[model samples]
Target: MFMRRSHDFTFTGWHMAGVVCLFFGTIISVNVYMAYQAVHSWSGLVVENTYVASQQFNGKVEEAKHLAASGLSGTLTVGAGMIRYRMVDAADRPVDADELTVRFKRPVGDHQDFELLLSPVGSGVHEARREVLPGHWIVEVTGLKSGERILHHSKRIAVTGPAS
Candidate 1:
């Protein structure tokens, strides 16, 4: 005859309740953590007023057309801890501006943003050497002549750690 040793541990309501609580507790905790992350990462508004911005959209497009009509164009390059900007006129000749303001910003956040007032380093070449971290950035280049904006260019670029 073989005898099996029996213990007094049984599946009781308390045990079931503990298991259920642990299961739901894990689910609820995870949900809470994910919710916090989602809310914290995103800002509620993209713009102050979408309606006003939309209304002015046509004018902006028309302005861009007018700029293109003037044959005023600009090229921006970000590399080697430096930013280089060049403007050319309709005749494909280099255009020089009195002053250039460059606004560097992250696409999603306004915290990591900086503005640089650059002077002409060479003929039609405006440059500034700044050590910026590698990430996605929006470069807004504004060229002004006699305090009037002549060129407005927005460029998106990915910054690399190494000079390229």
Candidate 2:
């Protein structure tokens, strides 16, 4: 009887220890999973905010096209510390306006592109103080009243040396 009792007590002790270990392990796993979820949620919010901001800017540009249709003709010149865009009206008259925004296509493999806002100095001329990269680029002019795009009058401009 004594030996039997001793054996039973040993088995009970081992079972109790296993149960404790399993409980601790389960709690730890749950905590780790919760932490991972929190981090994922935070990153998702940041990405969503970035996407929203970009969409807002695009919408504004679309609206400007209808508002500045009359002033959306001209040549865009990109050079060192300056970008010049020209526009002509339907009556062959040149209208000068300030704040001509130039947006360039994002570089290949890059997620963001360049945007420059230029001011008009003379008739049909808009100027900005910003250096543009010399490569394949797409230019779009905003702030025109004729609902036409002037900056990207053509497909793409290859800046070999400085923009003339």
Candidate 3:
């Protein structure tokens, strides 16, 4: 006659402790990773004051509409050691301004933001000699006439190299 042995397992305090630790540990690890990514990926500063920005939002929108209706458009070109912009009106005629400024800003942060006041080279064309770094950028071009903003344009672009 052969004797058979039965195997049994019990869920003890140690097992329960391990289960709780694993559950909480996973949650904590995910939270820490998310926090790290969030802090490193974005500047978290869209405006100096949210309330003030919100209050001025409508006015800004109206201004943008007016500017758009004016049909003033610009073409920006970045070269190895130069930045050029050409402005035109709705009729595709050259548009001149008293002052034109091009601002280069990063999409996620402002650390690399900079401005270049372009000098006109005739026929609504402006140029500046500056080396722009290769990366993703948001270009904001503002044109002023008699100290008042006349044209505001924003564009998102990816720069592979400064050659063009």
Candidate 4:
């Protein structure tokens, strides 16, 4: 009876060790899977958001191309006083609309930029009050139709201060 009881005790000890090992293994596996999913989830969000934003600009590019095909030309000039822009639409007609937006490229990077909306004062002319730093910039113009963009145009400009 003594030998039988000792044998039962040894078996119980081994079983408890096995149970502890299994519990720890399960926890480690779950942690690894969560880390893997976190990395993949963020990249998926970045790709999806970029795609959706680009789709919104598709129609605006098409409209700009259409206007350009009809001998329409525009000019964007940036200086110390104010940022000025002009747009000539198709059929040799000047475009003056209340829904024009102007965006200036910030010095940080291409993705980080500032945008300003200009008010149209006369035929084909738009003006905005901008206090921009002295640097090179890319100016982008967009036409909004009922809050949706319908045309886009871009140009490069440089702002410089007086010689010291």
Question: Among these predicted structures, which one has the highest TM-score?
Answer: 3
Q: For candidate 2, lDDT tens digit of each residue in 1-164?
A: 44545444345788989999999999999999999887654433334477788879877677557545734457777777677877767676777654467787733433446777777787777787876666677666665436543333434776666643
**Cα lDDT of model 3 by residue, 1-164, tens digit:** 97766866889999999999999999999999999999998999989999999999999999999999999999999877889999999999998889999999989877888998999999999999988888999999999999988899999988885534
Clashing pairs in 4: none
RMSD (CA, Å), each prediction: 4.1, 11.0, 2.2, 11.3
- Weakest 10 consecutive residues, lDDT, candidate 1? 38-47
Clashing pairs in 3: none
- Total clashes for model 4: 0
Off by over 4 Å in 1: 1-34, 49-55, 162-164
lDDT value, residue 23 of candidate 2: 100
lDDT of each: 0.85, 0.65, 0.92, 0.71
lDDT of 4 by residue, 1-164 (tens): 44545444345778989999999999999999999887654433334477777887887567667756656457776776577778776665787665888888743354436888888888888888777777767777887657655457777777788411
Query: Which candidate order results from sorting by TM-score in descending order?
Result: 3, 1, 4, 2
Where does model 4 exceed 4 Å of error? 1-67, 90-92, 107-112, 145-150, 162-164
- Assess candidate 1 and give its TM-score to the true structure: 0.70
